[model samples]
Target chain A: MEQFDNVSVSKRANVYFDGLCVSYTVTLADGTRKTVGVIQPSKLVFNTGAPEVMELVEGECRVVLPGESEAKTFKGGESFSIPGNSSFNIEVVSALHYVCHYG
Target chain B: MEQFDNVSVSKRANVYFDGLCVSYTVTLADGTRKTVGVIQPSKLVFNTGAPEVMELVEGECRVVLPGESEAKTFKGGESFSIPGNSSFNIEVVSALHYVCHYG
Candidate 1:
């Protein structure tokens, strides 16, 4: 979808790595928590407390999942899953627009 | 308010000034448009296509509105208005979080 309808969104953004990554919290009508965000072209490591499925809306990146030696490339319309309590390395090849669905 | 409820938010963001400023478009139920954004510490100039009310949620900045010789300092819980078709110069002393109401 191009947009999330009838949701609650935080006005304040979550800025990471000195603003290389910026995201807003979004709550669906059913109370599902998600984050719509953009990651500027940069390499970053992210640790997850909850299992996450990152749905890319636009742009490109290569992600190395937990225990994985090979990096998987993903782009707009693709997605990748990360296990809970795991850390992943991501190198954004282009500005990445994504919606993170959390467990 | 900390958030906007019952709104439609675009999945993609509006990235400006090479990612110095990032904002997401939000559409209220009644069709009013707004943007929740963050501006990293920097000096930047912005031109407006419509009248805008910039409501700061956090951080600080000095803004020189159109036709104003002096820059006015504004911080969290403060706001400034900019006329349509005008431009403003803002020097961000700290990262700024804001909600922009536009017409």
Candidate 2:
């Protein structure tokens, strides 16, 4: 879907990595929490508290998931999974727009 | 309120000024359109296509409205209005989180 319907969205954004990453918290009708965000062209490591599915809405990036050595390129319409209590390294070739789902 | 409830928010973001300003379009149930956005610390001029009421959720900035000489400083919990087809200049002293309400 191009948008989320009947959802609650926080006004304040979550800014990370000196503003390289910015996202808004979205709460679905079922109380599932997601984040809609953008990552500028940069390389960054993100640590996760819960397992996450990063669904790319647009742009391109190469990600090295935890316990992996080779980076995998993911673009718009693609997604990658990150294990809980772990981290992943991502190199954004272009600005990345994504929706992050927590598990 | 800290959030917008029962709204439809677009998945993609509107990135401007080379990622200095990022915003997401939100559509209310009644079809009113708004945007939740963040502006990094910088000086920029923005033209308005429609009259706008910029509600600042957090951060600091000085703005010069169209046809004005001196700039005014505004912070969180404040708001400024711009006429349609006009423009304004803003200097963000800190990262600005805002909701843009269109008329």
TM-scores vs. true structure, each candidate = 0.98, 0.98
**Interface C-alpha RMSD per candidate, 1 decimal:** 0.4, 0.6
Model 2 alpha-carbon drift over 4 Å, by segment: none
When summed lDDT is taken over every stretch of 10 residues in candidate 2 chain A, the lowest stretch is: A13-22
Docking class of 2: high
Model 2, B50-90: lDDT tens digits are 89999999999999999899999999899999999998999
Instruction: Tell me the lDDT of model 2 at A52.
Output: 97
In candidate 2, which residue pairs get closer than 3 Å at backbone N, Cα or C atoms, i.e. clash?
A: none
Local accuracy by lDDT, each model: 0.97, 0.96
C-alpha lDDT of residue A48 in model 1: 99
Instruction: Residues B15-95, candidate 1: write the lDDT tens digits.
Output: 998789999999999998899999999999999999999999999999998998999999999999999999999999999
